[model samples]
Target: MTAVQGFVRQIDLPQIHDPRGDLTFVEGGKHIPFEIRRVYYLYNVPVDAERGGHAHRELEQVVFALSGSFRIKIDDGREKSEYWLRDPRKGLYINRLVWREMDSFSQGAVCMVLASHRYDEGDYYRNYDDFLAAIRVAAE
Candidate 1:
């Protein structure tokens, strides 16, 4: 089992499979580790293009591939790791202050995101250099 860490987490949601069809769901403070405050999705991204080159100050999120597959690369100032969100029942939880970049999206991929906080532009560290400095200051 993949363990949750300060950097990232790979979690499996509850699913009920049947020969006819399947059912899946996610609930705040249940299947998800946080209380969901916002939700959004991303799609129609070019295969060569990447997304999410920033870190949040207090927000946390989980990214899931609802249609196809994609790779999420995350760094915690000192170490980096890559995780694949392939199954529809799976999600990658991004911890606060972790710099993230998503790439290698498959054709027709639809990425769904569940956020722990409401949209706040001031909470974002859009620059990699700024993200690095923020984590450094946070450690002390």
Candidate 2:
């Protein structure tokens, strides 16, 4: 495990096997570290594209790629790290105030995000340069 400055957590779940296929489920208190208030998925996206280039002020999130694969870049106003999510049973838990970006999505990739709070525009930091500057200042 990598040492990240902020409160991002990664959890690998146990995958259940079946004769038909595989099954993986994350309940509110089981696989997820936080209570889930919102659930959404992103798919049919183009290649060489990026999404979620922002930081949340108070909302915590757990991102998982249920189908194919994708790469997530996370920064915590001090250090940064990148994670490649390819398995359905693995999740990346991002704490509040951490900037995240999702990119390099493979074909048929389905990215699912579980949030601790509902949608609020005020919780996001959408500017990349501002995020970098804030990190630089915090490190000093």
TM-score of each model, in listed order: 0.93, 0.86
Q: Per-residue lDDT for 30 in model 2?
A: 68
Residue 129 in model 1: lDDT: 95
Candidate 1 global lDDT: 0.88
Candidate with best lDDT:
1
Write model 1 residue lDDT over 24-138, tens digit each, in one string: 9999988877899999999999998999998998888989999989999889888989998889999988888888999999999999999989999999999999988887788
* Cα lDDT over the full model 2: 0.83
Which residue pairs in candidate 1 have backbone atoms (N, alpha carbon, C) closer than 3 angstroms, thus clashing? none
lDDT of 2 by residue, 1-140 (tens): 22333578787887889999888878876677668899999999676889988997678888999889999998887688999999888899887778998999998889999998999998777997776776566567
TM-score of 2: 0.86
Each candidate: RMSD? 2.7, 3.3
User: What lDDT does the true structure give each of the candidates?
Assistant: 0.88, 0.83
Please state the error at residue 4 of candidate 1 in Å: 10
Q: What TM-score does prediction 1 earn?
A: 0.93
